[model samples]
Target: MLIRFKSPVAADVLMLGDNAQQLLRLVGREGQLKGIFEVDDQPHIIELLDAAVAAEAQAAEAAADAGGKAPARPLVSLRQRVWPLREMLHQAHRERVAVVWGV
Candidate 1:
């Protein structure tokens, strides 16, 4: 399943179901099929997502610093995966609009 996140200020963002659910959980909205991120809530949601990404990066860096073996090739980080939705939230906040999905 795929989730389509829509906002008046930006193009819709499509994400894999599990990935989208994880992101929703980050923003304190888990197991929700239909929901909205109000304009006032965008900043806090964005902050939560950003902090999760930052934490992931920090953990990876710490492991490397501890002499852990690196993967043979680079993998797509959560930062990369969540960038579009993050930007969408930013646009929504800037436009003072809400983002909704499964509505």
Candidate 2:
């Protein structure tokens, strides 16, 4: 299933089910078929996601620094995958709009 996130202030953002669920998990909204990110909550959600991405990057770097077999790189990094949704959240926050998914 693909999740389509829509907001009045930005273009719709789309993600695969598992990927979308993982992103939602960062903000404590996982396992729902449908949900909303209210304007009031967007900033916190963004911060959580940014921190999670940064942590993932740091962990990957640490693994590489350990000098075993270099960790296999993901075709798409978490940061790249989350960019669109992050932009949507930022736009919604700035414009005081809510983002809704699975609508």
Candidate 3:
């Protein structure tokens, strides 16, 4: 199965397994596994999510500045900011290793 979440202000998150490779292959590109972790490790997931949010914020600001408009406000709330990472833990493949976040 393939799962996707379209964020209002950031890149979309796509989740899928090897069985779904054919669908991705139709685009003439190979999909790479970026990072995967266990659900029991909350801290690791939190850090990854935080870094993603920060990066999104920075990109939005850069784009806005380049366009001569005010920077876009962060779409993530304080609470929801942590939700995606946590959700990833649950959704991630059990055999995958954790990707630690940079402080």
lDDT of each: 0.89, 0.91, 0.44
Regarding TM-score, does 1 or 2 come out ahead?
Answer: 2
Q: Write the per-residue lDDT of candidate 2 for residues 9-97, one digit (tens) a residue.
A: 89899899999999988889989989999888899999999999999998888888998676788898899988999999998898899
lDDT by residue (10-94, candidate 3, tens digit) is: 3444544442233223222236333223335535545555665576667777888898776546554433544553454434424
Task: Please identify which of the two predictions, 1 or 2, would achieve the higher lDDT against the true structure.
Answer: 2
**Alpha-carbon shift of residue 75 in model 3 (angstroms):** 12
Ranking according to TM-score, highest score first: 2, 1, 3
Q: lDDT-based ranking, best first?
A: 2, 1, 3
Q: lDDT of candidate 2?
A: 0.91
Which model scores highest in TM-score?
2
Q: Considering TM-score, which of the candidate structures 1 and 3 is the better prediction for this target?
A: 1
For candidate 2, what is the TM-score? 0.95
Clash number by candidate, in order:
0, 0, 0
Task: Evaluate residue 5 in candidate 1 and report its C-alpha lDDT on the 0 to 100 scale.
Answer: 97
Off-target runs (Cα >4 Å) in candidate 2 are none
Top lDDT hit = 2
Model 1, range 48-95, lDDT digits (tens) per residue? 999999988888788789899754434667898889999999999988
